[model samples]
Target chain A: MIKIETCLTPEILSLHQLEGKIAVVTDVLRATSCMVAGLNAGVNSVIPVIKVEEALEYQKKGFITAGERGGVKVEEFTIGNSPFEHMQEEYHGKDICMTTTNGTVAITEAKKTAKEVIIGALLNVGTVAEYLKEQNQDIVIICAGWKGNPSLEDTLFAGALIHRLQDQAELTDDASFMALAQYQQANGKVADVIQNYASHAKRLSGLKAKSDLSFCAQEDYCSILPILNGEAITIKKN
Target chain B: MIKIETCLTPEILSLHQLEGKIAVVTDVLRATSCMVAGLNAGVNSVIPVIKVEEALEYQKKGFITAGERGGVKVEEFTIGNSPFEHMQEEYHGKDICMTTTNGTVAITEAKKTAKEVIIGALLNVGTVAEYLKEQNQDIVIICAGWKGNPSLEDTLFAGALIHRLQDQAELTDDASFMALAQYQQANGKVADVIQNYASHAKRLSGLKAKSDLSFCAQEDYCSILPILNGEAITIKKN
Candidate 1:
């Protein structure tokens, strides 16, 4: 049986051996959701950088810079961390240099140890699941929690992916099982659950991103599978 | 409102500031459960040692050496990890020098940073909740997961404590919220939930300790509040 593991937060990612495994990194509040929407809207690729300064360097090289820190966009960046911003016609066919509070750091960390790194969010969960099932590789779902602490939305997203892959993969640890149980608890009212209970979602809502939360909570918004090939995240080739 | 935080595994305890906070340490599969039972059955105090060698040193000092490594009793020790053995009259009024795999390590670690450390298990969850509610301090429920990894039984036990204290305490982080949600999902069928899904319970079951699982799953089997006071876990004086 193919094995599936979960790193609840990037802090615990070191405890998991990522060699030869496909890592699915997610930040459901915004980072990954926007990445999916951006790629699906015809942005050529997303270059995830760890800092706003790195994104600025990419801006010098003619890439559209996008980032956020603590729910607000970095003033220096061209665009903020939002799926709607990424979906605009102005960004179509352009490569984005992106940074965010948690998602980019998690992606950078997972790419170092994982054989392949992919982004997973409600927007493209079904496609991510189908791709993993076809690849038949051992999997690790990395939740980009709020600064090394686990976040409800990211964990719930991990559970959603686990639930989809349960038939084809065996949960090898208690973390994966817990994620699945949490997902089962929050399946139908995911948006309501996050809006009402998730701390990060509340932070976003405070910044007037309630619509973003509702949009990110939707499943299969696009067929795009954002995979980190080297330093850039582009659509996975069929 | 009293704040309740959960460190899902002892590995994450360092991330939490435990000073001035009451720490509830639990290992539901056996260790903490048996500690509660042993104390209730009149074991004077439980000295949770990290190593069998230390327990042996305590044995030389006339304390009863009782511990298990991997669900089996040490050959040199007088007793194993079963709560039933701890409930026996033979061990009444004796001080137990104990060591287990996960629980003891967690207790030792928590004692270092927490203002007060108390043992928690299904066997004495009611008393734990009552004591914390009365103390009115910020609380951290530490789940002694399997060798630094999160365990189903322990996380569920944290959820149980969180559920009991939810009316009196505010959950401070996502881990506490997630634990409560999981507890809600497993409420009224906690034993069946662990029996069917907990990884540690499955390990114990493989070792013919199925009854121990049921015993550990029981609520308020004893009213004893075991608190660590300078190297020994003794009943808290009202």
Candidate 2:
């Protein structure tokens, strides 16, 4: 029997019994979204770094550095956190090293225990779900919530994924059920619900990142499965 | 400015930055509900212990011992986790020492950081909200989620409390807003929603704790405010 559990935030990642499970790490507004876009746009691979200095070290090695902290572009980096930037032709056919406030932290943590780790977002929900459907192992959806607290967008994205896979797998925990219920509550109107309720969206709006909000909310906008390979996220070439 | 944040599980309690804030600890299935019921029944004080052995020690000191582990009555305890037992005439005018699988652990953790800690449940939502309104401090609703994961019933109860306090307090973070939205989705039918989604309720049903479920769902059934006095939980005289 396949069981699916959700770690609603990275803060609780340690409490999850994740041995032998596949971890789908999500940061919908917008770190994982950016990575998915980069992989789909034909970037060679995306390396996730937890520190700005680590990203800078990769930049010194001639890799394109991209990330943000507190919703602003990091200093001395090649690009900001906007997923649309990953869609730029300049980054095509190149390796990108990235970090963000929450998503990288979650990915780094999940990698410690999960047998396999994949980046997930609303943009790649279909791709991630399809990949997980074929796996016979248990799944843990890790939501990269805002600064250690649960975020509406990530939970909604997890719910969207759960809604797709519920019939195929056991929704074994309350967080999964809660996320699916929240997703159902906002099923037909995802953008509107997220705009009004997501704290990170409101924070980004305050920082003039409205375009990133709209980009991150587009379901199945990207088809690439960005799976963690060693320390870098690379496209899973099936 | 009074800000209200909801920690959906004790596992993420550290991420909440709860220092100097008032912590409203909730374990809606039974622990906090029992504590609230005990206070309403005119119990002089209730002590929350983290271990079964500590509860036993308190029992040796003539305090009525009460608690459960894994949803079963602990061996050598005065009673199991039924709130109705707390409502019994025998417990009136006496101090009760209590512990449980999740709630007391959360209360013990919150006491380490919170300026004040109070028990919250559907049975005393109005009383808890009224008390918070009178205080000029930030509030953190710490949900004693089941075994390091978020529980639906606790989050829904937090949502119900948020629904009541949203107009008066700044719902400072995403968890608070997410919870309030959930409460709104089940506005007039909390019991039905919880019955269908809460994992702990289903677990209890397997253990034949149906009466406990019905009693825990009653909103404002008791008006007593359970607040922490050093290490013991006691009725707030005000």
Candidate 3:
């Protein structure tokens, strides 16, 4: 049986042997959600850079830079890390160079070891599961948790993705079991549950980003599967 | 208000600011549970060393040595990592020099940075909560996860500990929130839940340590709060 595992945060990503696994990376509060929304909206590709300076450098090369630090948009960037920004008509057909507090770091780190890295969020959770089924590889869902700490929403997303697998993969790790348990407890009201329970959700609410929370929480908002191809996250054409 | 945080596994323990926090380290399958049971049954103090070689050195100093690796006893030690062995008549009033795969590493690492390090397990969870309440300091419950990976039983113990704190301490991190959710879902059947769900419990069951699961799952089995004072874990006298 193919195995399903979870890295609750990027800090523990190194502990997982990612060489033979397809990593489904999620930052449900925004980053990966932005990628899915952008790709679905006709953006050519989303380039993820670890440093804000790297994204700025990409801006100098004509790519529209989008970035955030601690949920607020970087002052020098063309846009912030939000799905709405990614879905805007002006950004359609344009390429984005992006960086964020947690998501970009997780993406770059995962690229180092995972056989293939794909962006995952509630927005495209179903598509991610479908892609993984086609790949038929052992899977590890990597959650870009809040600053190396586990976050509720990302874990909840992991559970949702695993739930989609539904006995096709064996959950060999406790983190997978824990995620599934959280998803089960959420009882399909993940958005309300996260808004009320996640520390990061409260952080975003305080920053007036409640709308982003709901948008990111929407299941199958897009069928786009954003897989990291070279340095750019482009749609995975099934 | 005091804060409650959780390191779901020791691998992410460094991400936490442990300087002023009371670190409650738990390895519920055996190690910490053994300490709580042993101390409660009258072992003088438990000295946690990080290596089997160090445990052997302590045996040379006439201390009773107990250790395990991958759920089995280390051959050179006087006893293995079960609560029953620690409660034996010969071990009463004797100091134990112990080391295990994950628990000892967590205990030693926690001691380096945390202002205070205390052993926590289902066996003495209530006492741990009481001690933390009296101390009135921020608490970081560190789960000694299996081989630096998160484990179900340890996370459940973390939730159980946080549940006991229950509004007394602010649940500041997502890990703490996740733990509380798991504990609530377990719904007072933690022993059965763990035996049914925890991977570590299954491993122990394969080793014929099923009784240890039920024994360790017993809440408040002892009021002993074994705390690190230098390298030795002595009972904290209220």
For model 3, how does the per-residue alpha-carbon lDDT over A1-238 read when each residue is reduced to its tens digit? 6799999998878788899889889999889998888889889999999898998899999999998998899999999987888999998899999999999999999999889999999999998888888778999999999998899999999999989896788888889999998998888899888888899878875444888888888887778788899999998775
How accurate locally is residue A98 in candidate 1, as Cα lDDT from 0 to 100? 94
Instruction: Give the per-residue lDDT of model 1 (tens digit) for B1-238.
Output: 8998888888778889999889999999788998999999888999999999999999999988888897779999989898888878988988898999989999999999899999999889989999988999999999998877788888888888888888888888889999988989996788899888887766765545988888889887879899999999999989
Error of 2 at A178 (Å): 1.0
Tens-digit per-residue lDDT, A1-238, candidate 1: 6799888888778889999999999999899999999999899999999988889999999999998988789998889988899989999999999999999999999989899999999889999999998999999999998877888888888888998899988888888999999989985787788888888775665444888888998877788888998899999888
TM-score of 2: 0.94
Candidate 3 lDDT tens digits, B86-205 = 999888899999999999899999999899999999999998988888888998899999988888899999999988888688998999989988988888998988888788876775
Ten residues in sequence with the least summed lDDT for candidate 1 chain A: A199-208
Q: By descending TM-score, how would the candidates be arranged?
A: 3, 1, 2
Q: What stretches of model 1 exceed 4 Å from their correct place?
A: B70-72, B205-207
Off by over 4 Å in 3: A205-208, B205-207
Write the residue-wise lDDT of candidate 2 on B1-238 in tens digits: 5799999988878778878999999999989999888788877788999999999999999999999999888989998889888878988899899989999999999999899999999999988888887896899999999988899889988998888787788888888887887887786788887777788878876444887887888888877788999978888886
Candidate 2 structure quality by residue, lDDT tens digits, A1-238: 5699998888778778788999999999889999998788878889998999999999999999999998889989999889888879988899999999999999999999899998999998988889888886799999998888889999999899988898888888989988888888895688888887787776876444787788788889878888999988998889
lDDT of 2 at B183: 85
Worst 10 residues of 3 chain B by lDDT: B199-208
Task: Give the TM-score of each candidate.
Answer: 0.95, 0.94, 0.96
